[model samples]
Target: MHDRTPHAAAAARYPHQSHASGPLVDVSSPEGGPGQHGNTYVQGFGNLADPLAIDGFLRIQEGRVNQFLQVSDRRAEAQRSALQQAADRLSNIANNIGAILKLEHEAIKKQLQEANAKVDEAVKARDELRRLADGVNWTGSAKVSDQEIRSKWKQLEYNIRSLASVLAKCQTKVPSDKLTRTRLDEVSTAWRKLLVVDDYKNFLIGAYI
Candidate 1:
């Protein structure tokens, strides 16, 4: 209980210093930063609030993909149409060729038929000529007598009439096959020679008489 004025004055002046204290926590501790295990941190505060921007981006990407698909489909359709047109053109060409071949075949057949008919008619005419020539029997001798000369002349005249009549029938009929002009000229020359020989023989007989 020995109090003094100096001690009382010291206690009032050092009141805050005597009662205040510091914590015992460590100061040099490792924190979650550059050298720590959790090196990075993320936040949803700026971009997550804007829904319109995200939807617009998605719509743009979808539109680009759909446009590409549409272009591919159009190209494929154009190719198919071109191929179909080519096929149809080929079919038409084939059909036209077949029709032309058929017509050509028919024309050739008709020509052959006409040629055969001509051959048959020519054969019949030749047979008739052969029959006529075979039936005639000239019995006159090669002597200068009035009766023999008259008989030979009459027989020659009859043979000439028969040859003329056969040739007249051939002129009226139409032959389907092609005829050689040279062959007709040769036949005419042969007929003329026969007539000249008969005339000479008759003249000789008349002179002798």
Candidate 2:
């Protein structure tokens, strides 16, 4: 029979077994290097270098775009300012022209009134002279000779011709065209010459007497 007891003659030949001990070899390294420590450091490379650099480039591009926008905005503002200034200037010029036109109209009205007054005064004088002459009674002179009467008639005829010349000068014709500044000066000169009536003056003398 086989005995399984712990203390036997075969067990006495081998002592009690224990754990083995030795310096562990680093098999991964060709050259024997330092042993691995408990603490480990790992290094890894991801995509491109600095992500912040790419962000910076984008910001720069954005800045350029913003500068262009600012320039365009300023240009538009300048154009608007110029147009507004021009409009204001034109409006001022229009106002000034209106004022000048108003003054011209008033002046023309006053001139026409003066001209009418002169004409009325002349008519009144003529009428008064005619009435006075009709009221007076004429008597024939006994001493007046035929030659003297003929001489007096000749003088009266000469005076009549002179007065007719004056009346012709005073009368004016309607202007047919729009008068410019230069032409207005000419018209004024012509009007001034029309005020003197030599023919009318001669007629008044004879008719009144």
lDDT of each: 0.54, 0.55
Can you list the residue pairs that collide in candidate 2? 163-199, 164-199, 166-198, 166-199
Model 2: residue 206 alpha-carbon error in angstroms: 18
Task: Return the number of clashes found in candidate 1.
Answer: 0
lDDT, candidate 1, 1-209, per-residue tens: 74567756666777754533455333332653333222322224435555787888889999999999999999999999999999999999999999999998887676556545544554555455454456434566333456654555565444444434333322222224445334433445343244345444333222211
TM-scores across all candidates? 0.40, 0.40
Candidate 2 is scored at a TM of 0.40
Displacement of the residue 76 alpha carbon in candidate 1, Å: 1.3
lDDT of 1: 0.54
* Cα distance off (Å), candidate 1, residue 169: 26
